[model samples]
Target: MLDLWDGQLRDIGYESMGENGISGRRYFQKGRDNRTYHVHVFQVGSPHIERHLAFRDYLRTHPIEAREYGDFKQKLAQEFPYDIGSYIQGKESLVKDIEQRALEWYRDNSKLRRTTQEE
Candidate 1:
């Protein structure tokens, strides 16, 4: 991912930061409604980051689910246009639903090696 970002920055005539020991975590500024906001980027290998990437990949692979999620997000955004702080605040159940479903899928389809032999 850093390599990809390096290529992107080079393409845009920006220099790569070049191994600053920053752990690949980055923060940037964005503007919204005449106010600036800070955004943080999580690195690929970070523990919680994989869950988001996995969920995104799963949605990408499943068009129906992706569309459903997209619609849900749109509706949520519309309903909470001003309450950005509470945006997705109560969606823990939905998140857990996806997590459990994915886990069940992997458990049923993925093969695991036993570390011990039966006596």
Candidate 2:
């Protein structure tokens, strides 16, 4: 992947293979338009990643929570615009709660969908 990018990306374990219970890597890249993007490349299925995607999808569907998340992110950006780690740390608790809710929602909804489809 890095070779394909031709030095457009700065890889920080984003290419590491998920082996022996290890998770995936996250790649940071700069596009042609000078916009940065973070892409998580996973080798296998992980509950950790599942929860994250679930929370993200949950937020997208839940307007109030999404707004709250956006507001909190905005505040964090204002407080630590250049500190990526701190910005993520500041939202840890909220993210954790959302992760839990999202996992539960995923389980519940998946089961319901299966049942409904079967019927």
Best by TM-score: 2
lDDT at 79, model 1: 79
lDDT of 1 by residue, 1-119 (tens): 54555555456444444543345555333354322443335675676455555565567777887787668766777777777656566455676777666655544433332323322
Candidate 2 lDDT score at position 34: 25
Cα-based lDDT at residue 118, candidate 2: 100
Candidate 2's displacement at residue 74, Å, is: 0.5
Q: Mind giving the per-residue lDDT tens digits that candidate 2 earns over 13-78?
A: 223222323334443434422224445444455445776678878988899998998899889878
- The lDDT values for all models are 0.56, 0.65
Clashing pairs in 2: none
- TM per candidate comes to 0.51, 0.70
Supply the TM-score for candidate 1.
0.51
Best by lDDT: 2
